[model samples]
Structures are given as structure tokens and as C-alpha cells.
Target: MKKKLISLILTLIQLSVDFSIVAASISLVIVIILVASTPFTGFAHELFDYHSWWSLVLQAVTASVLVFLAIIMFVGVHSLLRNINSGLYFVNQNLVAVRQILWPSLVVFVLQSLASICFRL
Candidate 1:
């Protein structure tokens, strides 16, 4: 019984650490993208001038990825904060069910709309 309990505690600890790193990564990546957006625009334009076609392709792909990451970060952080709160008040009286319109969903929706504009260009 003692060994089992020890292993269970260890697993929970590892899970928490792993989730913390993932949360941090998401936040850090979002900040990096927002901060570096302008500089990357210059690089994108420079690549566009190269006439490779692949540059534009790569640019589109990279931008889409960053947008996706931003959305994920937003959602993940929101969920984390919710979990840190007292309980799932808005959704259910229990902890098992939760429903919230998180910002990450909004971000993804906006990004997809912008993507359509990019495709038209």
C-alpha cells in the first residue's frame, strides 16, 4: 500500500510539472510571436522578393502555425486560471463538468477569418 501510494504521488507530481512546462511554453510562444511580428514582416517581404514561391508558402504556413499556437496558449492559460479558482461555479456544482467561452476560441475564430483574407491576397 505504501509503495503504491508513493508511486501515485510521484506520478501526480510529474504530471503537474509537465503541465506547467507546457503552459509556460504556450504563453512564451505567444509573447514571442506578438513581439517579433513586425520584424518577421520584414523578413516575409524580403522572402517574397526572392521569386521562389516557396517563400510565400513558407510564410503562410509559419503564420498559420503561430496563430494556432496563440489560440492554444490563450485557451490553456484560461483553463489553468479557472482550475486555480475555488471551483467550477459557472458551469456545474461539481468539478467534473465545466463550460466556458474561453478567449482561445475567439482568437482561433479571428485567425481563421484573417486567413481567408490572406488567401485572397
Candidate 2:
């Protein structure tokens, strides 16, 4: 039980650290986009040209979701995959820690899946 708690705490730390790093990188991209929004009036015009505020809002939301998924894929999921493979043969030794990682991953997967579905139609 103590070990499980220890692993849980460690996983929480790892999750926060990883999330902050990924979010920071993606936020930089959004900053770039917002910065360019001023000079690239043409691009911004084209983006909001749909004439529907809802469409612009939806596009912005979609971009954010896509960026989020990319970060999860590059950082979170990739790291989890590496950890899984590394401990696969000895997983019984670290099942609790793996579970700690998986709960958030499943949530991330579901959210990303929901985001992608909106783009289908």
C-alpha cells in the first residue's frame, strides 16, 4: 500500500511536469498565431471569412484540440508507450504505477477522440 501511494505520488508529479511542458510548447504556437494575426490580415481574414462567428469559434476550438492531441501524442502517450514497453516483461512488478499513468491517458484518449469526431462532418 505504501508503495502504491509512493508510485501514485510520483506519477502525479510526472503527469503535472509533462503536462506543463507540453502545454507551454503548444501555448507558444498559439502565441505565434495570435502575433501573426495582426500582420497576416489576409490569413486571419481568410480564417474568419466564413461569415459565421460560430464557424470561427469552432475552428479555433478545433485548432486548440488538435494542438492538445499533438502534445499528448508527442509527450504523454509517447512517454507512456516507452514506459509500457520498458516494463512489459516485468509489469507485474509495477502494475500500480502503470495504472496511475493509464487513468489520465484514457481520459486524454477519450477527449481527443471526441475532438476528432467533430471534424468528420
Candidate 3:
């Protein structure tokens, strides 16, 4: 019964991970297209003044980058969880997978902090 309960919990977690992957994939694609087409979009130019445009672009780029990073992290986590569910949770590769999920957020936080300090001046 204990094993059955553990399997059930893992199964639910896997399902949640699958849904998150799909959601993250769709969001990442949409943001990528938006960032890519920024130069070509009239809304980016005609809809805002120079400073406003620059700020908007900076924010958009930051968001796009974060979303891209999140997608990578999500995929890494999905792989790690799948492996764990398959009974290989203690392997060496799991460490790499854990790093893949963590390093991007740390980098993003550092970049965001720097950007805030620069903008404050």
C-alpha cells in the first residue's frame, strides 16, 4: 500500500509536469516570435516615444529571456522527474539536471539587479 501510494503521488506529479511543459512551450514560442518581430512591428515604433520604446523593449526582452530560461528549466525538471519516477533518483546526472534548473534563475536575478541599479542612476 505504501508503494502504491508513492506511485500514485509520482503519477500525479508527472501529469502536472506534462501540463506545465505544454504551457511553457506555448508561452515560449509566443514570446520568441514577439521578440523576433520587434524591429518589424509598427506598434513598437509608432505606439511609443523613444524613451518609452526603449523601456518597453528592455522589459520585453527581459521577459522573453526569462521565459526562454524557464522553458529550459522546465524541460530539465521534466526529464529529472521522469527519471526519478522510473526509480533512478540518485544518479549523478540528476545533479546536472538540478543545476540546469537553478543556474538560469540565478543569472537572471543578477542581471535584473544590475539593470535596476543602472536605471536608478
The whole-model lDDT of each prediction reads: 0.51, 0.57, 0.75
Q: Cα miss at 70, model 2 (Å)?
A: 2.3
Error of 1 at 110 (Å): 1.5
Off by over 4 Å in 2: 1-28, 35-40, 47-49, 84-121
Q: Model 1, poorest ten-residue lDDT window?
A: 92-101
RMSD vs true structure, all candidates: 7.6, 9.5, 3.2
Candidate 3 lDDT by residue in tens digits, 40-73: 7866555333255566577567767877787778
Please list all clashing residue pairs in model 1, or write none if there are none: none
lDDT, candidate 3, equals 0.75
lDDT tens digits, residue span 66-109, model 2: 55545544464445544554445365435555555566567667
Candidate 3: segments with Cα more than 4 A from true spot:
37-50, 118-121
Q: Which ten residues in a row have the lowest lDDT in candidate 2?
A: 47-56
For candidate 1, the clash count comes to 0
- Give per-model TM-scores: 0.32, 0.39, 0.76
